[model samples]
Target chain A: MKKLWLLLLYGLLLTISSISLAEEESAFNWQFGVGLGVSHNRNLLPAMDSPRNGIPQLQLLFDFEYKNWFAETPSLRSGQLFGVRSGRLLDDFTLGYRLSNSERHNLALIMASYHDGFGYSVASGDGISSSKLEGLHNRESDFMPGLRYQFYTTDNQLLSLQVNKDITTHHGDMLRLFYGFRFEQHNWDLYFNSELSWYSAKLVNYYYGVTAAEVRSGRPQYQSGSGWRWHNGLVGVYPLNKHWITELGAGINWYTQAFTDSPLTRNNPEVVSFVLIRYVF
Target chain B: MFFRYRLLLLAASLFWQPAQAEALLSASPSNCVTLQQGRECHAQIQTAWTISQPLTVCLYLDEQQLQCWHNTASAQWQWHFKDMQSRQLILWQMTDSEQKLHVLATARIEVSWVQSAHKKRLWRRF
Candidate 1:
């Protein structure tokens, strides 16, 4: 599965590069920058809150669009630390191509990593862990391919829907719906985003379920069904000049009973907040 | 009837005379290019015009009048251009007796961007 994904990505890159060379009128737009930020986070697992506040972060900002193809790091999961490693260069990276493009509607095919898995020993150098997860098996992240549809009600308002299925691991599926509204005040650009996601039973169980063999005194074996998660955030961006920009945002994620009912999970919602400054080139 | 019409046409041709020469209007740096859409492009545009006879002339950007000259044969001015879309500059000859305006010449200033606003919004992040 990994090899197949790599092959697909390679083919996409080659196709885009060839198209770029053949078409001069199609402009290739890109932005690169570096950012420094401080964040506060709350993990989904219990007893894993060490060093959650005042965590300094270094970010590399890079995104590009060529004709109908694009690659970007979406800000939906920014500042959230899900202690799983997908072994990708950029967190929350998405590669997609628009199948249909118009003034009011857009449809695209995208490949991305939407969720991260956890291991039995959840301890990490960044200080997130829980004793209850010690006897569980390690869960692996999935690489999903999906379709995305976007509707623009106006220049400043957007609604998007995406559905993806895991092809690399677990064969689980996910669906996400997003709405964003943007407005400008003085020189500041502010955005309010709301997102809702639904995970299939296989996906939830693979990540949050506890097996009978790994049951402990207080950690009984539990299985999770399909679940929903909702997130809402407000972000503000101010350009200091032609090259410098500052951003600050805060958001919360609420998990449904399907996930919270699991013995390996916590009932409290997750909070993420950050402030960053970057220089664009 | 045909002979009478021919005579009238001959008299009219004999008395016909050419009207005034056409006015020439132009602007330097007629195109403004910006890196991003929805951002204003600024330019200092120098506009000039020449006419064969002295007449009351006024320059308009779209429908808004920018400057006017009184009984002038030629004139030039520097205009500070700031806008997000293309606009037309029209020179009109004003007749005092009729209080009517006639188009003399016109020029267009085009506004363009390297990236479209819609595409930028699709990938925007903070």
Candidate 2:
């Protein structure tokens, strides 16, 4: 039923966008594409093996804009592809409206999916045997509405900050800060970015806490506190032509002790890397 | 007497008739489309024109002179077109006797794009 509602919302947005296009074609723009890639990653949770081998990745790319309204997929590192697998056709998709626009500063109101939830049975079904994450309650992904602010230090440098609260599920809130620098060399666009995210105690505990009923052998009841995670990455993109582009990126995510110490997680930092080729339409 | 009158009328008609003056102008690949507005669209345009008489003619793009021919009946030129907006190519005849310029023919070059370039660059993934 929730999926039905989301689908209706998506259809409504598309209808409005088409009307906008009919009214002023020059003010509306859209791009759609598909991408295939291979990724290697270290699992952040105890449900998956650490340093997992190369996994096939498939992605659908869609971007839409009409005047101050825009819709796009959430950034790669936010939800770990969980939204895609959860029957959310839009999967961490964001719908936003620009509240302020200036040469160096921008502000927007956005609604998006910020994190992926977990189910113990789903983890076990994916080849886990006698995992410590067993017996934990399922965590449902949250849909958050927030505000984003961006500042451009220069033409090639950007700093962004966002704050969001879960209004649909756990009512937990999060804050994220990101900085990126881009440069072009020999027709290749290279970008370097660093991000820091802070999760509220309620949010962390909902995902990482071990309840009394979930206690097992060598696992005691534990409650998690608010914590921070850091990430840094470099990505490069080269346009093969007007319709084709290739991209490669690698990133590392470091979890604070408050998260790593949880029985549901491991202490090792996560590493994610991928290379993709896409044809734009 | 009637045959003689017909012959005289034909001779007068032939002497009074004026020569036909024609001018033609055209551009090959007259339209250019780009991915975004305000971006430079490049094209190699072949502009050709013909005139009935040997008159000095000059080609002007909008208000800028691109090329000129000296008392030529016809001419063709390979032009490098690079611009962000549509423009008109006008051919003008320079009359030495009247000390004035007369328009011979004109063609239009149109520029269009799929998207507007004025969009804000925010939340761009990749």
Candidate 3:
């Protein structure tokens, strides 16, 4: 219900902005297509092998700007999470107010989105209940409000930093930094983004910590502390013609000690990758 | 990149006309060029005309008119580019004796460069 109201409110704001700005030549732009993707990730329980699945993929590239205010979702290549079977209707949704854009750098106040928490009930028939990680409460999705800065460097390199705190609840506070290198030649474009993400203790604990009431036989109580994750990815886009492009990308996340110590986490390095062919209209 | 492509299409739309009275203009391949310092590119501009009257066609780089020709039929020009230090909007204009200048087509060329990353910056949206 809250999410619905938020969506309606955002629509109303956009309509109001559109009506107020009659002289400016601003339009809402969007690009969309469909493809197929596959990803492999560790199971929620320890001692279990990684699970891989294929899924239908959806690609969306959208941007709407009114004066200094803008809402944009660059691409699925950036910091995105892909599921094996399930899918995301949208990628990273960022609404921001540009403070200034000079030759060297750009600054803005941004509100960014974080993925939902993961929790599932365990059945006795299923194996690998080794450390007892059942009955854990689920954590809701987080919307983080924060500030971001981007610096353009020589040789087509970019550095970005973002710090945000969850608005839905104070459970999570995050700091993310990225260094990206972009290259373009002929009809091919490639980008490599290396990122480091810091999760506050409260945030990590809420998602991975074990609670007393949920504790059961052989499931000892566990408390997770603050940790960091290293995420790196590469995305390449090749034009097949005037209107079609083939996109392929792969990303992996390396868990920190605190995160791996959690009874729910299995793999140290989780892998996510995708491939798509899209036509622009 | 998307903005550059969109601008090229918008420039083409300005010259759209009916089949009977077509005054169409088009650039072969694309109209936007991005190059590093001391680099250059080439493009060919072609025009379609139905009336047999003489018309003046001019090509403008930034605000300066580079060349002009008086022709009775369709006209095509080979463009050679060099020494572009910044982004430039190139325009092709068509004018009759009545003193009306019409922008028949347009293109953009930009010198590729990147700023040093040592500068301070901050921005966010959510």
- Per-candidate Cα lDDT values, in order, are 0.74, 0.73, 0.56
Error of 1 at A120 (Å): 3.0
In model 3, what lDDT does residue B84 have?
Answer: 31
* Model 3 per-residue lDDT tens digits across residues A1-281: 33454455457658867676665534332233343444333433343332323434455544556656666654442233231113334435567877987666879888755644444432222222423434666555567778889798864688989898887754579999988887765434677888899999888777666678767675556787789988787777654543565667777778787777876666568665666665544
| C-alpha lDDT (0 to 100) for residue A185 of candidate 1 | 56
- What TM-score does chain A of each model score against the native chain A? 0.87, 0.90, 0.80
The positional error of residue A36 in candidate 1, measured at the CA in angstroms, is 1.5
lDDT of 1 by residue, A202-236 (tens): 99888887888878888888887899998888887
Task: For candidate 3, give the lDDT of residue A208.
Answer: 66
As a whole number from 0 to 100, the lDDT of residue A244 in candidate 3 is: 60
Residue-level lDDT tens digits of model 3 in B1-126: 999999999998999865432344444433423222232333343422223445666666667666666764466665554433433434343655523376655555533311112221111111
On DockQ, the leading prediction is: 1
Assess every candidate by TM-score: 0.66, 0.67, 0.60
Go through the candidates in order and give each one's DockQ. 0.07, 0.06, 0.03
Question: Positional deviation of A80 in candidate 1, in angstroms?
Answer: 3.2
